[model samples]
Target: MSVNAQPCPGPQPDALVRVDEGAIWRADGKPFDPLQVAHTRHALSAHPLLQLPRLRRLALSLAGTSHVKYALPNRKAGSAFHTFSESEAKMSIASTFDHIEEAGNWVALYFLEDEPEYGALLRDTLDGMKAQIEPRDPGMHGYSLFMFIASPPTVTPFHIDRENNFNVQVMGRKHLRVWQAHDRVAVPDAAIEDYFVHDTLRSLHYHEELDARALDFDIGPGEGVYIPSTAGHYVTTEEGAWALPGGRVSVSLAMTYFTTQTARRARVHLLNAFLRDRFAAAPMPPGKSGLVDHLKQPLAKILIESRMRLYGQAAPRGMSGH
Candidate 1:
């Protein structure tokens, strides 16, 4: 019901990304082209948000806090996974504000216009809905949604995402040094399966130490980093800050974008929904309707996994390193 958007579609997919740039992030890092990448880092000095400790705290709480996962593209996983040890399928973070509704998966109904967080997130979602250079409705894209999870000290047991994402850090800090995706890594379907079944980090074998596409520095407040769609990456939080007497937390923003393929996928899904309601609904009996699921669920998984392994690592989609 946000006036910001002409109409609302879908539900409960409330935790993937924000669309705009922090001016400085773009100014400093290089990757401006849509196809190529641009990765950058910032120290506490680079961010302005730190001046407001309350907001900083809120951001930290959002990160350290966990949420529910939604149905991710097929990576040989279960129906749904949780966010904190959480859900992955259409993941949702607990929103105190009603606008950021939580139907639990793929259904983040935003209450933007009223709530600041949801509103900010919704606007970001709209920005990424379609490329500014391209001509297409916002609905034309298949997007991803993920809320950054912070684990102090330990290596982020690697994984990939359901869609392309730019994991930008807003507060605290963590290092996720990753390798480009390669076919050489041998990850058993079982390991991916285990991730789904247990909603835990998938087990993978990187014959070599993880690749150093870049050694991700601890992204301090207001700082963010870019990533490719469904690209795999991981992180390790610094010990100093979190180890401080009272300790600080890490909260990063995930910017999920819609790719050409995902846009088409979304379009197909929408058309299927329309047809099902208009033509198929009356004719088909209950429980027999396939609608878009028959195509979407499988395609989602395939695409997610494919993107993750594209550079050739061959590991499960969500585990680190693309």
Candidate 2:
């Protein structure tokens, strides 16, 4: 709780996460696919480093960095993903955490691994699952962490992410609904292509009808869910749960990574979008044609490298030249 807390100490014996044995498989007992929704438990809620005081310090430390985002809470589940701006906050970044319960704020701390202590935590947590996750989706990279702290009655707008996510609930309760990554009805190929090509979420809109098709989870402290790459999902924190003081605060952590398969799919999407625009070619969606995907990977890589050189910018996350 001390504002002068030092950096996270080197690895301690106590584990930050503890996944139950046999908790990573599918309902039919098939081998885990990094793309499927799964449930698991964690010990993070009890970890000293995740206690509010330490987290407050972490939030304070990220005040001026691009790694932190602050926004007013969205109460509507069907709200547009971009309707809320991260830069528009009702409170100062330094004091937001101190008044989290009443601030009605939604704060996200991204890529925490950029901090030394958090990086070690991410590595140790993921290393423990290498045997379970790597066999299914190998060559994992782009390791990142997203910590979300919000006031009650907040909704995380429906959207898709490029990396596979292990969203663990550390405090309060959350009702999460996730549509399958390949469900075209929930998310069309054109929208996905636009996201990969232009980095836009304009095409991803949530409708009430999509809720019936979602895989839902109501999680609390120590509980977590796995969401696949590009899966469309949203979250709503419960109001008046009576778990914490004032029943007004909720916290969760998303541990995400990119795999070899995800990287390949991104390249394929890039090529498909190009073909669709340039030649009016109705290219198949990613993973639909293995041969075509193999052919496009190299071409996409060339294009990405050329663009980076032209603009003097690094390739975006999840689109690294893998």
Top candidate (lDDT): 2
Q: Report the lDDT tens digits of candidate 2 across residue range 184-226.
A: 8998887888898888988887899988888887777667778
Write candidate 1's Cα lDDT for 38-104 as tens digits.
4543332223332224333443344323332223322122122322322433233333222221111
TM-score, one value per model: 0.45, 0.87
Task: State which candidate has the highest TM-score.
Answer: 2
Model 2, residue 217: distance off in Å is 0.5
Candidate 1 lDDT score relative to the true structure:
0.38
lDDT of 1 at 16: 29
